[model samples]
Target: MLRYTLMRLGIFVGCLVVVWALVYSGVAPRGLGDSNGMWVVLLALLVSAPISFVVLRRERDRASERIVQRVDRMKSGLEASRNQEDAVVDGTTGAPGRTS
Candidate 1:
């Protein structure tokens, strides 16, 4: 996840630099008076989105798979704990707090 996030950020920053350069060089149109910075940032974001989506697809998938596995592990742990508690409450396990 961290890797993917960093990669995405890198792509955005790269686009921002390129867009800024283009605007500075008069190749790309600058926004209305005083809105040049905002325009550049927005354009960078727009350009980066698709680039990141395609370039980081593998990283994104790996991150998602890791997240899913972690969630599954948590769920299984909770189920096992619940089963143990149930057994203790039923007096089947020698839990310390059991009266019988």
Candidate 2:
């Protein structure tokens, strides 16, 4: 996840630099007034989104797989705990100490 995030941030920063350069050189239109910086940032975000989506597809998939594995592990742990509690409550266990 961190790797994907850093890559995305890198792309955004790259786009921001390119857009800023374009606006500075008068190649790209600037904002109406003092909003030039905001315009550049927004434009960069817009441009970087698609680029990041395409470039970071593999990274994103790997990050998602990691997340899913974590969630599955957590779910399995919860289910096991629940089963232990049920067994104790139903008197299936030979000796019962504490539920917690």
Candidate 3:
């Protein structure tokens, strides 16, 4: 999970760098405005990246929660079956000291 987060952060940063380079090199126009186009693009990227990351992280957390719930339910069912088996064994044993 930490690795995945780091990888995603690296990709987001790389994208920002690429965008900056493209704008700086004049390969892409900044925008049709009085403000420096690069600054505007940068601002937008800065805002969007964190929001996107947070949204993705929230979704990942929800999915993890669901998986944990399912696993716990499965474990509980297994335990119940084991207990039932134990009860059946005790019933068939008849007397405590008896063996067949």
Best by TM-score: 2
Badly placed stretches (over 4 Å) of model 1 are 92-100
Q: List clashing residue pairs in candidate 1.
A: none
lDDT of 2 by residue, 5-96 (tens): 99999999999999999999999999979999999999999999999999999999999999999999999999999988777666765665
What value does the lDDT take at residue 33 in candidate 1? Answer: 98
lDDT of 3 by residue, 1-100 (tens): 5555665666566767777776678886676576665575575577558765775776567667877999999999999998787778878977464333
- Superposed model 3: Cα runs more than 4 Å off: 1-53, 95-100
Indicate the TM-score of model 3. 0.43
lDDT of 1 by residue, 6-38 (tens): 999999999999999999999999999999999
User: Which candidate, 1 or 3, would have the higher lDDT against the true structure?
Assistant: 1
Clashing pairs in 3: none
RMSD (CA, Å), candidate 3 to true, equals 10.5
In model 3, where is the ten-residue run with the lowest total lDDT? 91-100
What's the candidate order when arranged by decreasing TM-score? 2, 1, 3
Model 2 segments beyond 4 Å from truth?
A: 92-100
- Report the backbone clash tally of model 1: 0
- Of the two candidates 1 and 3, the one with more favorable TM-score, higher being better, is 1
